[model samples]
Target: ATPSRPASGSASPARTSAKPARTSAAPEPARIPGPGYDSSADAQKQIEAALRAAKADGRAVLLDFGANWCGNCKAADKVFAQPQTAGILGASYHLVKIDIGGNSSANSALLRKYSPSGGTYTMPVLVVVSSSGTVRTDTHVTGNPSLTADGINAFLRKWAS
Candidate 1:
């Protein structure tokens, strides 16, 4: 299900003055400081390395599919970096951040490989693959920039190797 924020209440019909109004329908996503995805990096190679490490360590592979410009992805990264969630992830998963570019075609094949038949993907999709290379979970992070520690922790615990 798509996560949605509660409406900020309807605009007063009579009171309208927006200096000509904004062009974009959606509000700009808020960004967080972090190392964004390396689009030029060989994602396939990275995944293979991570899979090897995961296999050796008896851990799962966390394929974080997202783009550098994705605010939600950055937010999820922040959550993962938190000590609590970080420990859970570090112990049980080999994280591979895959950059799905502007058109969502950069890693399209892998996305399709991991997705359900005819499944539509959103930004910041998290595909959890076991050490044996079997997909355990293909899901979206909590939501937008408001992704929380508890939520992330739950997800990690549920799928942790």
Candidate 2:
């Protein structure tokens, strides 16, 4: 599961002076490290970079589309974190977590562009793409997030080689 990283503002304390005159503080949500990635457009850039990096190493582009608040996605992450899954993913794919809701407009657009036509599906949409930016296969494995690790590896092996 993704850790709730400290917000950038909370990472360090503010410098204070010797004489204290006023005291006023407000509450704010904790800043997470990987939460706010530039913007949706910027996220696409990162995904593109990931794809290019994969092409450089002769690996497949593994697009993992899910929102940050998705419980299924979190569980999927754990399954994907397993030793065997990690080994294969690390060896032959660009495992990218593309957010689908909240501020992830670009990610949602990408999903609609390639996946179903009527509406969006549940979290953890596992899509496989080629180096030429062509989508090979698409599957929604959020039903059994934990069971998707094996399925994901199988997909990569099928196309990566």
Candidate 3:
């Protein structure tokens, strides 16, 4: 038995395009603060130290609030793995990543202690803080900043300036 095609304008068969194979090697990614800091408190301590170091080095603290499941977070993760991005940020700022998944209390506490008034609690949030416990830029990427490095860099420049 032969299968007949659908009648004209009667919902055509589904079609899918075959993607071309990709072989080019992606550039090396930026490595974030690995999991050798000790514990949560230790992480906080490291964060504080980073702030001090940034101040001493005339830089800022960039706090990235995200979880392992977030798509945007995943993208930003790739950005964080980029050497150029890491070098740039490391030279001019302290990069901090917080997994705001379970234990909302910790995330909430951090947010309360640092976030500015009227600041919305959202995932994948990027905050630039000064050494003096001041908020510089609480700009929300709402997605991956990887695609907008220039924009983020511009913001960083303006804030640092």
Stretches of candidate 2 off by over 4 Å are 1-41, 140-149
What is the number of backbone collisions in each predicted candidate, taken in the order shown? 0, 2, 5
**Model 3 Cα lDDT, one tens digit per residue, 1-161:** 12344543234432212222233433232235742112254346656886877666667787776676667666665665566666666566777777665565666567556654545555677788887758877755333243456655565556651
What is the full ranking by lDDT, best candidate first?
1, 2, 3
Rate residue 110 of model 3 by lDDT: 75
Model 3 regions more than 4 Å off: 1-31, 34-43, 118-120, 140-147
Write down the TM-score for model 1: 0.70
Error of 1 at 141 (Å): 11
Candidate 2 TM-score over all chains jointly: 0.64
Summing lDDT over every window of 10 consecutive residues in candidate 3, give the lowest-scoring window: 13-22
> RMSD (Cα, Å) of candidate 2?
16.2
Task: Tell me the tens digit of each residue's lDDT in model 1 across 1-161.
Answer: 22332232324322344533655333332122245677777778888988887777678888888888888887888898787877777777778888786554647777777765445567788888999999988774333223689888888788887
- Residue 41 of model 1: what lDDT? 74
Please give the lDDT score at residue 23 for candidate 3. 32
Question: Which of the predicted structures, 1 or 2, would earn the higher lDDT when compared with the native?
Answer: 1
**What is model 3's C-alpha RMSD?**
16.1
Estimate candidate 2's alpha-carbon lDDT, on a 0 to 1 scale. Answer: 0.61
Model 3 / residue 24 / CA error / Å: 38
lDDT of 1: 0.72
